[model samples]
Every structure is written in structure tokens, then in C-alpha cells.
Target: MVSVALAKPLDPCESPAPFSLLVPVYRGDSAHRVRRAIDSNTHEQTRPPAQVVIVRDGPVPQEITDELDRISAASAVPVVRVELEHNAGLTNALNTGLLWCSHDVVARADADDISYPDRFERQLPLIEAGADLVGASMHEIGDDETTPLALRQAPVGRSEIARVAKRRNPISHPSVVFRRSAVEAVGGYEHVPMAEDYWLWARMLHAGADVRNVSEPLVGYRVSAGSYERRGGPRVFLAEMALQWKLRRLGYVGFIQWATNVIVRGGYRFVPLKARETAYRFMVGHRNS
Candidate 1:
């Protein structure tokens, strides 16, 4: 078992160290899943987290709040809950959490995600090694335990990530760990209604930040089947395309590559449910890609 001895309480006014993990939660998510993600890190063998800030967009159920309270009591790591008076969108909630980050490095977590035990243990060293941003491969999980979903790996190295970021988001937002200075230098997370993380990555690259990827699966991204189908529809694709075009206008990459990759990757939508599940199985089990 990994030890949690190094974990410590967070001081709001000053960063105790160089890294803090931030997770933003909307009211409707499954509290159990959120607790799982939080527990994974708090129990891991890691450099003591300066804080694990969970920013809530609005009021949550009593049960969920109680769960948070229980997690706080059981874990040595400080779990700070920041509640908003009203429901704000993801971008605003994330920025709110960012303001509370008291560390030079910031890691992101999603409410429904399950991070591997070594997720931070692996990424933090890379940040200390001087990479401005680092992300790892992700394994997708679904509601049905019998089937898997998509497994993705991003390019490694700052130059490669920069090249990929020009066309598409090479890193998974939930799996990314970045330098607070680099993010703040880029003016923080923009209020893009969609693809906010992609937009921020492009902005960071334009500002000359180094980004890289660890070649290991460090997270299990839950894709609620119904949610995926809805979000992966044409409207979101078009919105993403528009965001990519905005990146092009900024001179990060040409429109052709972005368009081509979008079309090619978009073809995955045509995959039948069973085929998609099969592909995920192969991707998850296959070591080398």
C-alpha cells in the first residue's frame, strides 16, 4: 500500500509547495465517483499535496455534502470545498478553483473521473523536471462494467505536443498537470463556452510554454454512453472546429491539418456500439501502439 504520510493541510494565503490539485464539481454528478477520484490521490504515495480544492458550482444534496465531510475527516490531506452562490459554467468554476490554488503546479481532475494511484506520482516529477505542462494517456470506462470505451495517448515532448496542439488537443484536460506560472502567464483559463481546455492549451503554447506527455494510462475517463452520444454529435464537432479555426487565426497551425484531423477522427462516430467497445478493449489491453 502507498503511504499518505506526507499529505498536509493547505494554507489559503500561501503555497506550501509547488503543486496543488484542483477539481470542479457541478451539482448533478454522482458523489461516489467524485469521492473515488479524490480518494485515489489522497491515498497515493505522493509528495504532500498543498491542497485538494473541490469547487462546487452550486448547492449539492445533503448526502453528497456529508460524503465530502467524511472524506475530509478520514484523509490527512486537506479537502477544501468552495461553494458558489449560483450555478456557474465549467470555465467560471474552474477559474474560481484556480484562484484558490496555492501552488506553483496545478493538476486538474474531473468529477466523474478515476485517476490511477500513480497519476500524480508520475506527472509531478516531469513538472519538477521543468516541463510547463504534462499529461498522460487515459482509459475510458463506461456505465456497463462489461465494456470499455476509448483509450487515448498524446504525443510526448514540448515540441511534439505543440505540433499536435496546433491541430487538436493532444492532452486530455482531466489528465493534464501544468505550471501555475505558465497558466497564469497565459491569462488563465479563457471563458470559451466549449473546448475551454483546448483553447487554454493553444494559448499556453503561443506563450512558449513546454508541454509533454507521459506514455502511461493515468486516468479512467467515464463516458456515460448517453452523454457521449449527445456531446459527440455534430453541433459539438462544429463548435470544436470553430475553436480550431480560432487557433489557426492565432498562427499556431494551418486550417488544413486541423480540418483533416477533425474529419478523420470524426469518422469514429460512424462506429457501431459493439465495434466501438471492441476497439476500446484492444486499445486498453494492447501495450504498444
Candidate 2:
């Protein structure tokens, strides 16, 4: 029997995970946000990543390019930039970036997210201990990092993650540090539209990967004004439906479960905007200080 070594309750010791930071940046994203995200990784970090892999997901603004160059030059940690000719979307861009990650573990970061200084140090031991996919909780920052709107917690341990994932996305995408080989073994991220991370987790959980999450909030996820609108609408609903179908096809869910999932999620999306907003607030848990 292959017993997985799970992460112990964290102590003060700084242990960096053997990993590369995977960040995909494009034109539409905030260049300043990208700089701050990388800056967060560079300071107060007890264990910095082996390399920060930046995937240029197409032609970004000249300002973003300059910021990347500036950040790279200033970083004490190694930085690898992979330039793609055209925009391949997040899933494709991530898949492309992973190929260049030399380390076994890969920490994910979005261009707009603000990672806490000790984030990777907290997760490194978990990945080192045998977690194939490890994520941490997050604060959904509204106006600023100091003014967080909600505490979006994730399930702890593999079984908990598996259970929670069956219902909804249990891992905060940006808070995750996962094994590159394990991802590759499961065929990596799919080309799903809005459900890319969810789809990947479903597949990984189904494949029996040892997924876990630390209890601490390691990143502050920025929420835009149009977040709810962008997350709703017919297009998003159809994408969720497609994800369910794919999940069912992967044998992760039975036909009945798939149908139920579609109905449940679809209904949730269609609820009155205010009610949906309330539920989102509820799901995200308590407000952050």
C-alpha cells in the first residue's frame, strides 16, 4: 500500500517546496497586479520558488512587458519567460507553461492575485510530504488587500477535498501548489472555458491524487466589480453544463449525478442576482479584516 505523507500542522520553520511559480499574463490583465503578485513572492519569503515561470499568453501591453522585464531583473529567484505567438487562453497557456517547469511541484498564481509572503513556505512541506495537489484558503479582497470581503476557505486533506469537489470547487485556484508529474499523469488541464480549474480538480480527484489544503489564507484574491456578472449568464451556464457532461464521461460522476449537478448549478446561477450574491457571500465565509 502506498501511504501518502500528508502535511503536519505547520510550525515556524521555513521549508520551501521544490517548485516553480507558474504565472500566465496577457494584454487585458493589470500589469501592476502582475508586478505586485511577483513582488509578493520575492519578499519576506523564507523559501522562494526555484523559478518563476511567466507564460506570455500572447501579446501583452508594452507596459506589462516592461514590468515583466523589470521584475525579472530584480528578482533574486530565477525567472523563466515563455512567449507564445498568440493567445491560447488560460488552460492552454497553463498547460504550455507546465512543460517548462523544471521542478516536481508548481505553484499557481494569477496575474491579478496578491500572494502572501509566506504562502509557498506554508504549502511546500505539504507537497514535499506527498500531496499531489495542495491549496490554501484565500481572502477575497475588494477595494484593497486590507479590505477583504470574504474568507474563502478550502477543505483540508485528500478525502475532504474529494468530497467537497463533488459539489463545487474546493480549492482556490491561485492558492494551489501541485505536483507537475501528477498533473501530467492525469493528462493535465483541459481546454474547458470557465471550468478549467474545476475540471482539472475533478479529474485529479477521480484519478486518486492526494489533494489537500492548508487552513491558512495564503493569497488575497482580487474580486472585480463585474465578477458576479462575468461569472453568471447563459454562456457560463452552458460551460458548467459542458463540464458536468465531461465529468460524467470521465466516470467521475454517474449519469444521475451529472443531471443533478447540471440542475443544481444551473439553478444557482439563475437565482435573483441579490440572492445569488448572498449565497456567494455565505459560501465565501466570514469577512476578512
My TM-score estimates for the predictions, one after another, are 0.80, 0.91
Output the number of the TM-score-best candidate: 2
**Angstrom error at residue 213, model 2:** 0.8
Clashing pairs in 2: none
Q: How accurate is candidate 1 locally (lDDT)?
A: 0.72
Show the colliding residue pairs in model 1.
none
Residues 1-289, model 2: lDDT tens digits: 1223333433457554457889999989888888888888765566778789999999988999999999889888889999999998999899999999998788899888888888988888777766788889898896578777778877786677776777688888999988887787778888888888988888777776788889989999998777776767788888888888888888888777778788888777888777777777665454544
Alpha-carbon local distance difference test for all models = 0.72, 0.81
As a TM-score, model 1 comes out at 0.80
lDDT, candidate 1, residue 246?
A: 70
RMSD of each: 7.4, 3.5
